[model samples]
Target: MSVFRYTLLASVVLPAALSTVPALAQQAPFPADAGESDGADTIIVTGRVQRLYRAEQTTVGKAAEDPMNIPQSVQVINSELFTDQGARDATDIYRNISGVSFFSYAGVTFRGFRQDQSFYDGQRGNPFIGFSVPQLFNIERVEVLKGPAGLFFGPGSPGGIINYVSKTPSDTSSLRMVATGGNYDRVGISAEATGPVDADGIITYRVGGFYEAMDPYRRNTTNKAKIADGAIAIRTNEGGKLTLQATIYDNYLRANRLRGVLVDDAGNFLTDIRWNANEPTDFLHLKSQAYQARYETSVGDRVTFDAGVRYFDAREAQKYHEPRGLDPANPDLVRREFRDQIRPVHGLSFMTNATARVDLLGMEHKFQAGADWYDEKNVLDSRILRTGVTSLSLSNPVYGGAAEGDAARAALLPFTTTDTRTKRQGVYLQDQISLTRSLLLVGGVRYDHFEDKVTTSTGGAVSNRSSYRDGDVTLRTGLIFKPLPDISTYVSWSQSFEPQAAASQDANAGGPFAPVTGNQVEGGVKTQLFEGRLQANLAAYRIVRRNILQVDPSLPPVNGVDQLAPIGEVTSKGFEVDLAADITPDWVLLVNYGYNDTRITGTVAGQAITNAVGDRFANAPRHKVGFWTRYQFPVLDAAFAFGGEHVSSRISLSGQSVQPYTIFDASITKGLGFAELLLRVDNIFDKVYAASGFSAQSGHFPGEPRTFLAELRVRF
Candidate 1:
């Protein structure tokens, strides 16, 4: 039998066999009624003592609903999971999520789509950039909602969205600190504190931050970053609350490489090398800051309103040498190019929401209405100073050869500049209706209007200006049935829309292209078995995306660009199973498996864009699996965890194949009187592989080698 079959069987049979075991105090019992508010009922699962995988409530749907009550796939990763896995960013956590892949700076891949946008406290005001990895020191938890969420998050990729909930102020005094040291000359320190500010206990505050520096695994590569976050919460006399939060982050990187070694036609790695592709003098610097203010109040016992405003500003500057291609004269020598760029961006958002719960016609209904507006402006100045002639040896490379100082910087002058602005406004309404004691229905609709404009300046002259506008409507509906209090079966249908800026300049007689539309149909089953200690979920879904821009093969190139037409469609279907269990007081288990088949089903007649209709989506693996287990030793007061990740062969956009590889990892943590020590090792097998990529030159990013870290955490 295949590994997938065995995993599926284990996922189906483990809960049944474990149900006979006695319950433990690791996880709290589920609430008896679903109508209760999630104020004090919300459970925060951490790794300090007993850590459970299950989460009670999530805001993925723009509402605090029970995970079992929702008719969709929702995965929650608590702080405990973060600490055990040593997850500092999305890349660290992607291994545990089935069907999620990382492609370097291309962002994250989910459900056969590449997703780069994220939601912070359910707000969109930041970019998912390579230098701007999310800082987890101030994060409470991360909720991942799979499938199209346009009705709640507005226009976005059909792959779904990642929501990060920031840590908030508490009414109790607490302080914690962590110091870490690891291979590659890594060292870091982080601290957090929260407490009441006044005698009445009506006001509270939280302050936390982290500073980390590392000499990366690749030769001549280094990274350093610092983040600070603060929040204040005020309780009004009339049963209302206000929160103000701010954050600042600065990151610097030297000799950061974007791609790796080249591969031959047979997908054989030509270079047995691991070093920075960039020159030693290259550097990337980024700085960003954000502020948010929100107020929430209750009008009556059943009605509540919330309003918020957020602003973010960021700047990035980078000077690097990029790999171009192999030299025609000698394939052993790789050509290189030099680039210098600077970008500054600003974003603002405003939102308000009202929710009410009422009993009508012998049933209960929860209604919500909200409106949001966002605008972002960006400026880019870039130049390519040199190309082709510069080269590097494939087998061995020596640094410090490239010219540095003002001479090199002066060569990148007279940069081309671009200014772009985008704005979006959306309004939505949703209702969760209880049709019967065991049946629930959810439905929502949203309308979005968006506009984008771009202007370019070349050679100190205003060159061109282009603008586009469009409007779209999205819908979401689901049905959930429960035969047992701990079991739920659900089916859902949803739609998403995203405006296309690429087709705005197409020289075609078909008129302006329409926005891309995506629809999905999904069915799933969720169960809380083993006395609420084990949570299992199985989901199957099919999604179709239409109105994709395809090149017109029938028409010759016009002005060096092929004519475009919006007559393409893509489809993705998959099955996913996830299991999380705290089998006993000392044993914990987490498992996930996914099988995805994504293909381009239709396109303009007799036209192909390198990727054909029958080919699977680039960088999307057909099979993925992850398994992890941890056991705590009573006498030693320590926990040990081991896990492995697997991925099947993947094809790139140019049809270059990426061989499948599996990696193993392990970690151990011991608790003392006031401090906890942890040791973690990744890629324990020391297997050399490529994680994911697109091409031989600009892709084929190499995976990290065997790495280890030791950390000490203290709490007061």
Candidate 2:
């Protein structure tokens, strides 16, 4: 069957499934019995259920407000949730969210847009090109705003935005220590401490750090990383504050990168056969340092102002092997070559916002204005060693073929050295009007300016220089209605733009390509059920994107890649539902489901494109589901948690099909005075599957096998 058929099936089935849940709740016997607020249950559940999948307030829109009133699809993952799940990277947390997935060379796919960029404290951060994953030890919480959020985040993927909030100092002093040892010979230690720096309570400080090393499940793979983060704040009695924060990250991975097994036509990867398609000497190193300063003060009772500045620097070096193709004479033999490269990037950002409340036309209104600017520079130095390990047999593999040393390395002087610089600026204004006692209107508009410069050199001689510039205005508006204090229903429309960094294939055209534009219309309902202990949200949305990059199929390959053109349009529509409940004081449940359908809608009339209209985007599964539940026994001072995830079949870049797969995980935790012990197991069923892959490439990444981890945590 085709993707459209499956999407149609889901569209019919999911709504029907949702309609029955409320009836089932009415007949169920648990919420009435467990909803009672006993002293014991309150003490135990308060530390667990209240913190899961919930945030009191967020600054995703430059305004702090309850997520239920945001008029969009938003999900918050606090430290407690990720800590319990043993999350280390984006993949771990995205699994619990609807309509989010990972892919190789694509970074992360949200909705139908490939998002390679993420934000820190509402500002742009370093891009993740699938080479290095960010650390989470110092993160206080993560907020994900779904759909077109360009009004606040400027140019980015239309799918949504992700913001990472760092931990800061508090009045109460606390310290925590954690030691962990897990499968794959993993062991690590981490520490976090925060306290007041002065007796008068005017100064406070916080520090957090972690170190870990492990041998991964993949053969000949080893990894190690170290991170440190610190912050300090000074406060005045008048509610004015000044803060400074800094962080350092160093990471190294010596393993087979971009190496995976080949799948059959049916998308079945042989479980017993596994080999590293790259040389054992392959490795990657990344180091970064960042600092920020922020100040906030109130001019009067109804007005406030805030400002911040941030700077970041990073360096990367890697040597790996990239796959070519299978030998024509031997289907089981795969061809590979060596790649050596280095990149150094640095950037600075400045932002400010002011908010005020006023009464006009017999109603009160809140208004906000903000502006932000960022400048970044990047340098890429690349080289190639073509004579390394060439082929590897799928059925059988042996070591000691190619060794790592300067003697075996050779530089390709013909390769171009590129230096790129980018500047982005945006100014936005927002207003919240209370139309009536239970009705509210929210709206915002942003004007953005973007420009880029590229300089290329060959063998120490300058070859070419190019510059491009563009600007756009984005808009957002929403309406929210509240029949009850805890129930909210809203509808929203938003716009987004993303500037293309590469030049167009048509040299005769005026200049670089125009930015891709996106717009979305969404409606949703959010409510607190069962006396505010259970939260449920349901949303439906449709997004249309124009000026998408497409390649001309009639033209021959250029340097093993096709020439690009920008004359494509695509549409993505989906329904999402999320539920988190403390269904009895001791029982917690989390469930999320997404039904997504994405397809190319338009292309040049006569020019053939690789992706035809009505074809689904590569690696975007139409169906995704997740379920997790936990139960705590107060008497035994213990808790048990289990969850499983499922994804439907996906289409690859080359139009190959990938079969659907599922995985399960479970964990147990016991409290011992000021310390706690946790035992967790992932991939409990030992199912063999592909986490992700490139359709046109030979890299079919195999999922990990059954693994176990044990952690001991203490607090003082």
Clashes of each: 0, 0
Task: Note the residue pairs that clash in candidate 1.
Answer: none
10 residues in a row with least lDDT, candidate 1: 36-45
TM-score of 1: 0.91
List candidate 1 segments past 4 Å from native: 1-49, 127-131, 237-239, 299-301, 403-412, 502-509, 554-562, 605-614
Query: Residue by residue across 1-716, what tens digits does model 1's lDDT show?
Result: 24422332332233334333335324443334322112333222123333465578997876667998888898988766787777887678887787678755637778888778888888888743444567677778889999999988899988788898888899877777899877777899999999999998899999998998998876677899889999999997586889999998888888873566677645567876475567677888888888999888987778888888989999988887777767799987777777788899989999888889989999899899999999999889888766333587777876665545422754646888998898999999998899997999999999999988888897779887777887899999999999988999999999998888733554443436778899999999999886667889999999999988777777777667667777788899999999988766667889999889988888866666334324567778888899887765545556667788998888765568778889987776766655777777778768888787567675476788877777788766
Local accuracy of candidate 2 as per-residue lDDT tens digits, 196-268:
9999778999999999988887767788988898999999648788889999988888854555667766777
Please list the C-alpha lDDT of all candidates, in the order they appear: 0.78, 0.75
TM-score winner among the candidates? 1
Model 1's C-alpha root-mean-square deviation from the true structure amounts to 6.3
RMSD of each: 6.3, 7.2
